[model samples]
Target: MPGFDSEFTPITRQRLFAGERLRAIRRRAGLGQAAMAARLGISVSYLSQIENDDRPLTSAVLAALARHHPFDLAAIEADQPTRRFAAARAALDDPVFAGSALAADALARIVEQQPAFADRFIALHAAYRRAEERLQMVDEGLESGGGRLPWEEVRDWFHEAGNYVDLLDRGAESLALRLGDGDGALRDALAERGIVVATNDDPATLRRLDRADGRLAISAALPPESRRFMLAHQLAAIAFAEPIAAIAESAALRSAEARRLLAVGLANYAAGALLMPYERFRAAARAFRHDIDRLRLHFSVSFEQACHRLSTLQRPGARGVPMFFCRVDMAGNITKRHSATRLQFARFGGACPLWAVHEAVAIPDRIMTQLVETPDGVRYVSMAKGLVKASGSFARAPRRYAVALGCEAAHARDFVYADAIDVDGSGAATPIGISCRLCPRADCDQRAFPPADRAIAVDPDIRRIVPYRL
Candidate 1:
């Protein structure tokens, strides 16, 4: 870079931006682009295009960057890994799975656990996005006529589950619920009442309880945790499922499918409660700091299963933190979320980058704590931890992930991870909200989409630094 500074061109910055950290390194070594591309087993044309900002860097190339230049791809990916999952969601768009809540949930899990596959799916989705965008520009009205987006429903399911299964586990622990022998226990318990657990692989049926054979089958491939949840639902369905449906009957849903998913999800929550008896689980939660992994082992539930149960700790006088939770893979798309709090989180839209939940993806596997205050002065202490997936089998192993949790800052003093929260306490912290779409912080660098209720008013008279002047 010393003597070559004058010879350098725009291509230099382009290559650097495309995950090629070694560009400057190679130049420092006095190697040419042709030489570097030759050593990389790639063509000079591709390298030239990458160098000149003509091409995007794929994960494959980013992986190579890590090997060759020792850069942190996870740090680089802090921008948006959820794009991978959003793409995979586009693949499982078959009407059959789209209509089934179980299939939709499975699709979400797959996308989150297998980002490489998700990336391919996203590329495929990008094509669709382009076509749809072009068609919209041509005729926006025609593009509006379709069934509700399946992804939106699945997103709600996750959010309702509170980002991870830990909240569910916490909720169950409040009651001392335990899923003994996992799915086997639910099946045995159901069999006692003349109900049998069955699998319906056919694309036509999902979660149908066959009374004639006294068997219940789900139409999708369920992970063990989900299977246990479904079985638990069967037991609850026999008793309170009808009652829960009665409740939903009076409520509003985006669609019949969404309503059904919500009803069954509640049934599953009830079943989890039965296994964990209320007072006993609450005692355990008080004993354990609400740490999910320990609760999972104690209750014999999966991490997600445990987290899901934790979100339900609200019952009149007995309540834990009225917490809001969410999970995101390396990408920004919210994979799951849940809230008893008043926060109305975005189900599929991007969250503000400044939010601690979004930052959790960067420090995978370790717990990250933050003291975040909303622009309105409400403060919360947030904690995030990384989780690796294991299916007990090879083919369906899920990818690793990190999740975050936070409670009102007033209650932050009671949590163990609070002391490490990244707060300077001098009020220099960036103001953030539940989602960028809802946040009103005009000076926020992380603002993406404007809040739904606000309109952007641009004045032609003054030159504004930001895109829109409100």
Candidate 2:
């Protein structure tokens, strides 16, 4: 409870001029100048001036508009100009640009004078970084259609989409509103379809559906939260089948197996959305400073489910704190990964050994927090916890994994885990990276291997933790 309510604190800015964003809101609402002006209780000329950037937006008009419309006022107040300026600066700071980085003033000038070019420059840098990452990653298989696996193809599809399916999310939210009841919603939904829902004592499968007998059985071995999630997943797979199929079919996947995998992924996304309705869940998460236990209890969801849902809160306007979420098995294999921030997870091999998630995997049920700086100089506050799911019988082994969730240091105030660390102290962070092969920190003593593309020279007489020098 110490860091709760941090996100509700108001932010102060020196100036606000987001005319383009205001104009976009008006266009999205399909309202003409006169109508928009009337709704905001302002004159048409005044509205036109504001939209054209001839005048700054006042708080009173913004308040009036928020009262009349369903817009995310916080997002509007965040100022696109400031965001673009920061993005331009960050892209320039990438090591690829190194000593040729532009000054803050020069970057600001470009953002102000040629916004389109600035945007393009940032996008090009992102593409370059992605290409660099792919090159750094170990080849899973050949790039040809025959060698690419369905799971990998589906993973890439979700990654490219930023793990957010807008249409499916909104549709699931609508269904949630209709259901009203919490866990009972899933049962009622299945019951309406003439299917009897019950729990099965079998430990072999999570859930089994028998259309022949019009019955659905969920594994009784699961915890209460997971049971509910499994129910939602089964229900979503049934209700959202058409849209899920459409999305899968729309993908440029080469094989039928890839399409099938994509459809399952979409259905899983929809199930999470249905169980934790976006607007309500995001609001609660902000209130709790993204406390996983608080979120899981409030939403009646599993911890992993809550963490996974947090990563998908990228709904443009009503976005939550941007964060990366991943799950690591006991072997340090990252089974799940997504980033709404600059921190990308390694696509192959284990994650960086210095990451706290690896430590959490050894110590189950305890939350571990760490302040880490990636090679790019961006700091993050991470919270990781190891979990064990019961197998309900001694004959079977339980599933064990650790989940990590974190955001960049800029949003540290809104992330509760950062409270115990010094966010402003540059030297307080432990240096970390995506993986050993992808990391650029040659001085790190815990490095497992050298960069795949960088040649190293070995000193025959030299003695150090690592035998070779970069």
Candidate 3:
């Protein structure tokens, strides 16, 4: 039988030792060192040397164990060294070590010589992350009255579900087909159900549902796309009421309000899916090379809608590029966020000011693109656009926000915004952070505060871009 030993080089053997694993296996098998050595036809001293990492276990011994004992050779040879090294690198990249120059070789050596210590450090780092999230919840008033915020709970539910709801999507798509396709097909379907679709001039009334009278009134002030979205949303709530209720019931939310809000969220998701079927939208996205404007026009959806729908293209085998989508208000408050990629937003504060999203807010109606590199060395091709929704009256303030969408650099070739950008070229990408409090970049001139986890050294006499040194 083919064995893993053939894939191992001498350097790999030195880097990865299975001593601890072998000892655990032997102990679990209820065999003493002498007995185990005798079964493997090796001297007791040789077995002791292998268990202590003084000698590498031979392939013959591994095969013997596999043949006669309940041993998992693949488990013993799982590339733990690489995983531990990556974990150590991630931990050391924290703000606590901002100015410390720890090389990759040093981190690898720590994993090799002090694996137990490395494991402890990694676990501690995970605890720190949880603590940070808790602090953020406190700051956001989520910990008030000893209950989690409804919106936050809904957000977490979506995140855990991979930001995709197959049942909702398919149901909505089937309804869309039954309703027929055209500019007035949705309205016709609603009218057939004795649901009067009317528009209101009152700027304050974005949407109102009158179940007693069987009417749905939407604000005439909204854009065409938003108007259609509102209609589709109401349609989903009425047509798929049973399915939505079943899903919400299964959630077991802590509060009735949470359940209600989740129902609304699910209905909205279904609306988006109804307007843009998964397969059609995904194929169009690829054909347009993921140009937001093109997708918006082709799908007859708003720019924000197109961006949000792109983040949900997480179908199992036929998946599109994984992307992160977010919307930030003029005050830098994150109103909506979801990521199918590894790019996670800050749970507490505003996004990094250096990011192009903020700049997009200043230049409304224009799309801004940037190549950004995070502290972990992963690069992304990000695009953002600012939008304003008119209130249709002088007394009411228009809603303003910027929506950002992006994917990892590895998928840049399929992204239109990345066509003229050199994502891999040196000095081509802007260095950005998750947030100031959690960012570990010591030289960032736009840092609003020193990292909360790191110590700050102040020098009144030698002030640079920032007042303190990390």
lDDT of each candidate versus the true structure: 0.56, 0.79, 0.78
CA RMSD of each candidate after superposition: 23.9, 9.8, 13.5
Ordering by lDDT: 2, 3, 1
How many pairs collide in each candidate, listed in order? 45, 0, 0
Q: Judged by TM-score relative to the true structure, which candidate is superior, 1 or 3?
A: 3
Ranking by TM-score, best first?
2, 3, 1
Q: Give the top-scoring candidate (TM-score).
A: 2
In candidate 3, what are the lDDT values of residues 134-246, reduced to their tens digit? 56455444313445578878876887687899999888878877776654988887888889998888889989988899888999998999999998998888888898999
- lDDT per residue (tens digit) for residues 204-282 in model 2: 7888889899888999888888888887887888898898989989999999999998888888899999989999988
- Model 1 residue 124 CA deviation in Å: 50
Task: Tell me how far the alpha carbon of residue 423 in candidate 2 is from the true structure, in angstroms, after superposition.
Answer: 1.4
Clashing pairs in 2: none
Segments of candidate 1 deviating more than 4 angstroms? 1-185, 197-212, 215-227, 253-255, 329-331, 359-364, 386-402, 422-424, 427-430, 449-470
Let me know the TM-score candidate 1 reaches against the reference structure. Answer: 0.54
lDDT of 1 by residue, 1-470 (tens): 00111112212222224435445444532457887676455688877777665665533343343333221233333334423433344344323243544233344345445656767765765576446334422332233343336445544454434433343434444333444445666777788889877777753444788799897887555555656667766777665655567755654566777777767666666667756555565556545656666776776666666555566666533445556677777777667676654344554455668876666666656667677777556566777776765444455555566666666653443355565664447774556776665566777655665665578877778765667754
